[model samples]
Target: MNQDIIKSQWKQLKGEVKQKWARLTDDDLTLIEGKRDVLEGKIQERYGLARDKAEAEVRDFEQRLRKH
Candidate 1:
């Protein structure tokens, strides 16, 4: 997803982000905030996903959040 869309609806996405990344601590979410790159990196590191797949998952989640 594009950064514009993510920026527009990040507040709503945050909850979904937390749910999907349940292993991430509150501090992790706090640190991620609106930075998709950071979020992608953390998800890759914590979940052992390849970089491209992790990014796509984050993009998918962000897009799903925007649809609501």
Candidate 2:
């Protein structure tokens, strides 16, 4: 997605992100905000997943959001 579109949709996207990643604590989302890389790092640490897997998960989640 383009930066402008993502920026405009952040509020809704953020809520959806939190809902979809129920395993993520509020503190983790707060720290990451809209930064996808940071979110991936937290997912890796919390879920014990590989970096690439975490990134893929995040990407897939984002794609799902876009579809909806």
Candidate 3:
């Protein structure tokens, strides 16, 4: 999803994000606040994924959300 759409829908998606990345803390979600870059950073930090992999994961997650 686009940043604007992501931000607007964040509250709804937050729980699903947590479920998918259980290692992420609530504070991390707050910091992410629907910014794709921030989400990628957090995923990298928590999951130890490389930058490209983190971006791919976030992109995949966004695609899944769209499908649903």
Candidate 4:
């Protein structure tokens, strides 16, 4: 999914995101606020993933969303 699309659909997507990355806190979600970069950074911080891995995971997530 495009970044703009993600941002626009963020409210609807937040539940799915929480399901996918349960480690993330409510505060994290609020901080992310539809920014892909912030989402990636939070995922990396919470999961101890490298930047590339985080980016890949988010990309895969967006692809899956597209399929649905």
Candidate 5:
């Protein structure tokens, strides 16, 4: 998905994001605010994933969301 589209759809995506990454708190989502980099960083911090892994995860998530 495009970054702008992600940002625009953030409010709706938050619940799905939380479901995908249970470790993320609501505060985290607010802070992320649909910024891809921030989301990846939060996912890394919360899940102990490396930068590359986090990026890949986010990419996969975007792809999945695009499919739906």
Candidate 6:
């Protein structure tokens, strides 16, 4: 999905995000607030992933969301 769609639909997507990234806290989600960069950073920090890996994971997640 596009950034605009994700931003507008952030509330709805929050639960799914939490489910997918169990290590993330509610605080992290709130901070993310549908910003792709923030989400990528949080994933990188929480999962101990490299920047490229974190970005790829987020891209994959976005693609998955689009598929649904």
User: CA RMSD for every model?
Assistant: 1.9, 1.9, 0.5, 0.5, 0.4, 0.6
Relative to the true structure, candidate 6 reaches a TM of 0.96
- Scored by TM-score, the top model is 5
Q: Candidate 6's residue-wise lDDT over 1-68, tens digit each?
A: 78999899999999999999999999999999999999999999999999999999889999998889
lDDT, candidate 1, at 8: 73
For candidate 4, write residues 1-68 as lDDT tens digits: 77889889999999999999999999999899899999999999999999999999999999999999
Better-scoring candidate (TM-score), 1 or 6: 6
lDDT-superior candidate, 2 or 4? 4
Ranking by TM-score: 5, 4, 3, 6, 1, 2
In candidate 5, what are the lDDT values of residues 1-68, reduced to their tens digit? 99999999999999999999999999999999999999999999999999999999999999998888
lDDT of 1 by residue, 1-68 (tens): 67776667677777878899887777877788778899999899889999999989987886776577
Clashes of each: 0, 0, 0, 0, 0, 0
Give the poorly placed runs of model 1, Cα more than 4 Å off.
1-12
lDDT of 2 by residue, 5-67 (tens): 655676667777777777888888778766778888998998899999998998888787678
Most accurate candidate by lDDT:
5
Runs off by more than 4 Å, candidate 5: none
Candidate 2 to native Cα RMSD, angstroms: 1.9
Model 3, C-alpha of 59: deviation from truth (Å): 0.6
Model 4: which residue pairs collide? none
lDDT of each: 0.82, 0.78, 0.94, 0.95, 0.96, 0.94
Task: Score candidate 5 by TM-score against the native.
Answer: 0.98
